[model samples]
Target: MPGISARGLSHEGRRQLAVNLTRVLALHRSILDAYIIEFFTDNLWDTLPCSWQEALDGLNPPQLATMLLGMPGEGEVVRYRSVWPLTLLALKSTACALAFTRTPGFQTASEFLENPSQSSRLTAPFRKHVRPKKQHEIRRLGELVKKLSDFTGCTQVVDVGSGQGHLSRFMALGLGLMVKSIEGDQRLVERAQRLDQELLQALEKEEKRNPQVVQTSPRHSPHHVVRWVDPTALCEELLLPLENPCQGRARLLLTGLHACGDLSVALLRHFSCCPEVVALASVGCCYMKLSDPGGYPLSQWVAGLPGYELPYRLREGACHALEEYAERLQKAGPGLRTHCYRAALETVIRRARPELRRPGVQGIPRVHELKIEEYVQRGLQRVGLDPQLPLNLAALRAHQAQENRVVAFFSLALLLAPLVETLILLDRLLYLQEQGFHAELLPIFSPELSPRNLVLVATKMPLGQALSILETEDS
Candidate 1:
């Protein structure tokens, strides 16, 4: 929850960060490239230098959590008995420095309330049909879009990948922004429309009951549109929906809340190519799903740099919630063994059919309850292998005993996760800057609540004080 305050990155700052990422990523490519599922099959432990293995081999889950992951328990001091390699220590410090700060610079709706006690009910109406995590996301993002639209003098707000319209409704009805919600799924669009009506009715009743208590901000429901936005080409359907009353001269602010894969790319493209779009705020996820030909290396600098390529596995790893996993390690719960259990299953799978490499196994319920041998049998059956295959009890026990080592390695990989996410976001910011637009990346949400917390904000004009204002909670 703690991080450095947000600062806008200069052109030179971004370039240096990119160069630093390229160097660090290459130096630690072995750790990043090694998938946890291939731990036994690939002899992943041996892959680490003997010095690293010695230091990390005996670490308990809680020890790994505090020492390597920087999540110290209350009043717990971490003192190492065995001297760690200087290179390893440096890698930890370097990774932390290169990653973008993910703590929110902005204030939450709860904190912005005049009475601190009323924080719980500030967003009460908007909380219907929404989980706590999503409730937090929509309120923060909607407030941001409202500020951007007001600053840019945008007449409309376009919410791309507007799932179930939680964000669109909040922006339109709660913040009084003219919003257009677009989603690729027809069913989800219909569901959003239903929720919109339900919310409108609820607000009307609340207003009638307590007319003096409720502020009368002119509220409107967001118009829902069903369309798949393609990153390669601009869709007329996307642009034609805006019925701007401002003399057909519609200045727009585009926003996407957790737009997945190339869909986020589409938002960036539309913002760049369309003159109507005056500003953009995008939060992207599912990096593994991004297309190679068009999705990554958005700026020319990264494309030209050697060893800048991020394979699908590495990209997938970037999407993990580092903070959440660190908490799990601190707890040292049963779930920590899942990774080791799955890895052991992989070995059994390979022996059954040497060609079957890392095949997907369906989730086994209450897997931690099952013994290693039982879990392996169930996994084999799930992967269409014979469950009756000869058992290797000794090998399975050996793998189980080394569970701590497996967890330590996984934690190390997670330590580098933020750097990968940082590089991807930096590339987007650089891309916008390369095209002569001003862009800044800020961690707008709590990383624990949302792993993909960094939001890339861009405006055609220079954002001077607005950059800092975006971080400020309204008083």
Candidate 2:
């Protein structure tokens, strides 16, 4: 008989009704037993107290209804009716809680961010024994390749601008696919060949030296199967001529690993229009090569895009103080960090030695007006190195500067570096899609391993299908 009366329940009555409902559920048991069992077993109820059963057994519906109807002065009994399905729900949700555990292989939010190394193993094969940092990058590239294979169904690959042929050999031997490495720089191409031979000899020697070491070596090695091609001719001549040589047997894969500036854009264009070329994967770097739209002729397609403009240098014409500082830092190489620490020491010394703090006595000069040799001589003189030493101070200074500059510039340009390269890569992807190839942006390496980690994957799906896929993502 306990329930909400016709007059509707007061706040107190509502509370009482809820309590009564709970009691009814506990007493009857059969009323909502299945739902209750399900609720208790569900992940949502994992943290619920075991004493919830006792709280639900003492509710009185009739008294709750009377209080709600405001009939304290009247002896007349009011008809009670069932209100909201409180008892049913109370039975269903006694101990409910949502599960937060991740399925295996799926990284949890915290895990991915806090401990990236947990998933670092996924990339280990690509990086093992090569370089500690390069592993993550190789893994990222592997992920991209897998995604490309799934999306396009094209497995054949060609690596343009293939430096050292390490990645080229990787794709051939690791992925079990045919790979042709094309390099424009004769010296690099030759170096890659020589390295390839040396690697093969090393593997042979290792196998002979200790068979166990061979067993531990990765299945794919730089010595493994990979055809090296020297495209001494410009990309334009190579792309068109290479198409004829393939004889339309398999999809011509045009890929470039860190293709600088125009080289990347050329690959995109080649894959777009050339029917014989089936897929294109290019990761572009060095945007300074792309002339402003008005400065040079871009492909008709790229020039037609809305707001399309020729790319320009970040700090046109002149280097800023930060840039100069970075250049000096990079030339210092691995010792750059140490040199920076030393700079702090120098600052302290400068403060202590007031006489040494001349107006123009900064460690390095900002202007190129004086050759680096002259600057070094000036520095050595200040630091008491012989100013007239017969040593080629110019070359030594230049070399030191160059070594330091690599690391210093990298640290300084970290912010803008990825943006410029990413935009160029996206542009190439758009070009590929426009040319009738299905293209996707994939992370080819970890940011730590290499800042330039994006790969644009394009394949000839149907005539317009590739564009549609790209459009869907854009929308």
Best-fitting candidate, measured by TM-score?
1
Summarize candidate 2's per-residue lDDT along 71-100 as a digit string, tens digits. 222364634343424543343233111100
Error of 2 at 59 (Å): 64
What TM value does model 2 have? Answer: 0.45
Best by lDDT: 1
- Which runs of model 2 end up more than 4 angstroms from their true locations? 1-130, 133-135, 146-155, 201-248, 291-311, 315-423, 462-475
How many backbone clashes does every candidate have? 0, 20
RMSD of each: 2.6, 25.7
Total residue pair clashes for candidate 2? 20
Predicted candidate 1 versus true structure: per-residue lDDT over 1-475, tens digit per residue: 2332225457887787888898899889889989898999999999989999988988999899888988888899988878999988988888777888887754454543564333353456788888767776787788788888888888989999998999999999988888898899999999999999999888888888888857556677999999988888997766654574657678888899999999989989999999988899999999999999789989998877778899898899999998899889889999899999999999888888999998989999998789999999999899998898998999999999989989999999999888888888888988999999989987878677778978889999999899877765555
Query: What TM-score would you give candidate 1 relative to the actual structure?
Result: 0.95
